[model samples]
Target: MHWLVLIISGVFEAVWATALGKSEGFSRLGPSIIFAVTVIISMGGLAFAMRELPTGTAYAVWVGIGASGAVAYSMMTGAEAASIAKIVCIIAIVAGVVGLKLAS
Candidate 1:
């Protein structure tokens, strides 16, 4: 359950990140609200998950998920360029996250 929450929180981190970019320094109302809401949820879940998981493993996995999710979303939306190198790097991040889970 903690791991599940942690993973979901990681995805919310990506959502908040993307919404922040769209918020345009909080000038936009909709995305700004989205950012605010998701950020809270993300942080709360992380804090909760940290109670059971090792800090290092939890943090690394959270960051890995968020970073890869944001990059993947941007690539899909054409907001960022897609390249073989970038894809490989995202895959590496995912692999690391999985490795951490298995190690734990």
Candidate 2:
């Protein structure tokens, strides 16, 4: 159950990160609200999951999931370039996150 929550929080991390970019430094209201709300929710979920998981494992997994997911979304939307190197790194991030999960 805690793992599930952690994963979901990781997804929210991507959401808040993407929204933060879209927020344009808070000049945009909609995405700014999204960023604010999701930031709280994501952090809250992370805090909750931390109660049941190791600090290092939980933090690393959270960051990995968020970073890779946001980068993938940008690549897919053409907001960021989709180069071979970038793809490889994204895969690496995902692999690391999964490895952490499995190790846990």
Candidate 3:
């Protein structure tokens, strides 16, 4: 359950990141609100998961998920240009996340 919450929180991290970019320094009402809410959820989940998980491992996994997810979302939406290198990097991040999970 903690792992599940952590993963969900990581996804929310990506959502909040994207919303933050769209928020334009909080000038946009909708995206700003989305960012605000999602960030809190993400942080709360992270804090909760930290109770049972190693801090380093949890943080790395969370960041790995968020970074890869944000980039993938951007690429899929055509907000960011896609390249073989980018795809490979995302794959690597995923692999690392999986590796961390396995190690744990």
The per-model lDDT (C-alpha) reads 0.97, 0.94, 0.97
Error of 3 at 48 (Å): 0.6
- In the range 1-104, model 1's lDDT, one tens digit per residue, is 99999999999999999999999999999999999999999999999999999999999999899999999999999999999999999999999999999999
Residues 15-103, candidate 3, lDDT per residue (tens digit)?
99999999999999999999999999999999999999999999999999999999999999999999999999999999999999999
**Deviation in Å, model 2, residue 51 alpha carbon:** 0.4
Candidate 1 overall Cα lDDT vs. reference?
Answer: 0.97
Model 1 pairs in collision: none
Q: Any residue pairs clashing in model 3, and if so which? A: none
Residue-level lDDT of model 2, residues 1-104, one tens digit each, is 88888888999999999999999999999999999999998999999999999999999999999999899999999999899999999899989988998998
TM-score of 2: 0.96
Supply candidate 2's per-residue lDDT for 3: 86
56 Cα displacement, candidate 2 (Å) = 0.8
User: Any idea what lDDT model 2 has?
Assistant: 0.94
Better of 2 and 3 by TM-score: 3
When summed lDDT is taken over every stretch of 10 residues in candidate 1, the lowest stretch is: 55-64
